[model samples]
Target: MKKVALIASVAMVFSLSLNAWTLGKLGDFKFEKVNDNVYVMHGPVMMPNKENGGFMNNPALIESKNGLIVIDPGGNYNVGKNVLAEVEKVSKKPVIAIFNTHKHGDHWFANKNFQEKYPNVKIYALAYMIEQAKDNAAETWYGILGSLTGNLEGTKPFAFPNSSVDHKETVVVDGQTFIMRHPAAGHTDTDILIEHVNSKTLFLGDNLMKNRFGAFDESSSIFGNIQILENVIAKKDGYKDYKLYVPGHGPSGKLHETLDPFLNYMKIIIAGAQKAYKNGMESYEIKEEVYNNLKDYHKWDDIEGQMGKHLMKAYSEVEMRDF
Candidate 1:
């Protein structure tokens, strides 16, 4: 009886351990090999009701001949650690580079973790993002959320990138050419797009979300975001053969299917906001009117609250004279 009990206990412990390492959910991080050398590891999406639903989505991992390049390491250390472990499972080489598509915590908060693990790894980000991370107020606010969400590990004010690229730059990694382009400022001061030349894969961070939740609060200009979407639509026409397109918030896409709906929504909101601004409507009034108009637009129920919050921010920024 003692032997049976001991074996049973050991089995139970082993099972628990295995379950912990398994992927969490659809929004949780998962790994996929989109091409021969490129791999994408998507993080989980925390919803509003969930404790940390707004924390981190999935990150994308790209393997090149040079080494490994990870984009937006998620919001916490554990997410970064899990993604690193997944990469190691596939390749024995160290992660050579890390990229931040923007300055948002969910996208770039895990930089310190990756840097600590891979000391020689090169960190790449836009110049504006490096500056934005220095905002004490923003850092403190996000720090509180990170702590609440249990994502505060390695969450200190991060060091800026040793290498910065703006506008358009190209680097050859593992024989594959990656073109990093800052088409225009939309989601934030800087929104970057990474394109793998050979494979025709594009990694669009928060600038493009698969879900309609459409968080534009962090954006400096909602009109600028609309222009960015137009640019992407124009680019999509040229890359009809593109295989994979990864977003910051949801699953990947093949064509620019996700871009159209988002652009249309932005146009509608901007038109309404323009009328309100012309009519000398206060910021709050404009926000309310726009929210009511878009309240029932498509599947608004899924992300109305989050979208409303962003719309208010955008209305204030876009309509405010100083902004």
Candidate 2:
């Protein structure tokens, strides 16, 4: 992706001041600068709900020559609006694009809100995510989260990402090269990875968490997820000297150090679940067994809700030989 000289003109016109940033809070989270032009709003480990103000997933903002490019805006209107509020403080330029890493609500439904704010902006996603967003896959989440969030009135239904790209597709937006990758079937069947070539940053949408593993639905695969993480860790030669490894949740950090915890957590979870199955224990019983064995890791982040569900899923993932 060759950079256009005009893009530099566009960047120069906007005198964006980083010194006067909104350092207080965007709802309950803060917009943190992880790299030279990349800003990330790191959300809490808790699930998406009214209590957390719908700030459950990390939304990253990339400043480019043309305009801002938002990654995984969020699950609802409020979170997206909050992200936009922060964007307004940082850059006066309009948003040129929005990329959703997957079909998960906490990852992408905010497309609608972003559209209303920046009507001409393009929303990009994997073809699978676009298909899921149009069909019952997204509809089911509308119902699930509606109830989970106690029918949050302003939260809208899924707005499908219009521009769909295939695997290994390279997109040049605002003078930045974004290389997208699909790592088997992990996180979800439609998990899409975005590699910002300029920053050497990888925005892993739920494929790998930083300090803690979070709860997931039936579409997730522990085995496939392990493969994704292993590939990322091994490919440091390609993704050399990582400035930031952004996960869907948790604080961003160096790729290897950030990914090590999730890898170790999965190893212990899968092994303990397999042991529980051998002991003739049910999923519910296995949860207690696995939790007892891996109790130390429960302190990672939001384990009160994520640990039990992860153990159950790990047991099923192993039982079905889907690893």
Clash-forming residue pairs, model 2: none
Q: Write the per-residue lDDT of candidate 2 for residues 1-323, one digit (tens) a residue.
A: 24777777567545343333232353345567889899998876666666765567888999998799999987776666667776777788888999999887777767777788777888999988888777766777777676766634566655678898878899999799998888668888888888999988999889877655666677778888888888888774244445779988887888667888888788878887888888888767767766777766767766766777877888888788844
Full-model lDDT, candidate 1: 0.66
Task: Give residue 122's error in model 1 in angstroms.
Answer: 0.4
- Encode model 1's per-residue lDDT on 68-174: one tens digit a residue: 77877766555566666667766777788888887767676677777888777788888776676665424854665555565565566563455677767887656
Measured by TM-score, how close is model 1 to the native structure?
A: 0.79
Error of 1 at 195 (Å): 1.5
Q: Where in model 2 is the C-alpha error above 4 Å?
A: 1-28, 211-213, 236-241
Which stretches in model 1 have alpha-carbon errors above 4 Å? Answer: 1-28, 47-55, 135-141, 157-160, 212-214, 217-219, 236-241, 278-302, 313-323
RMSD of each: 5.7, 7.0
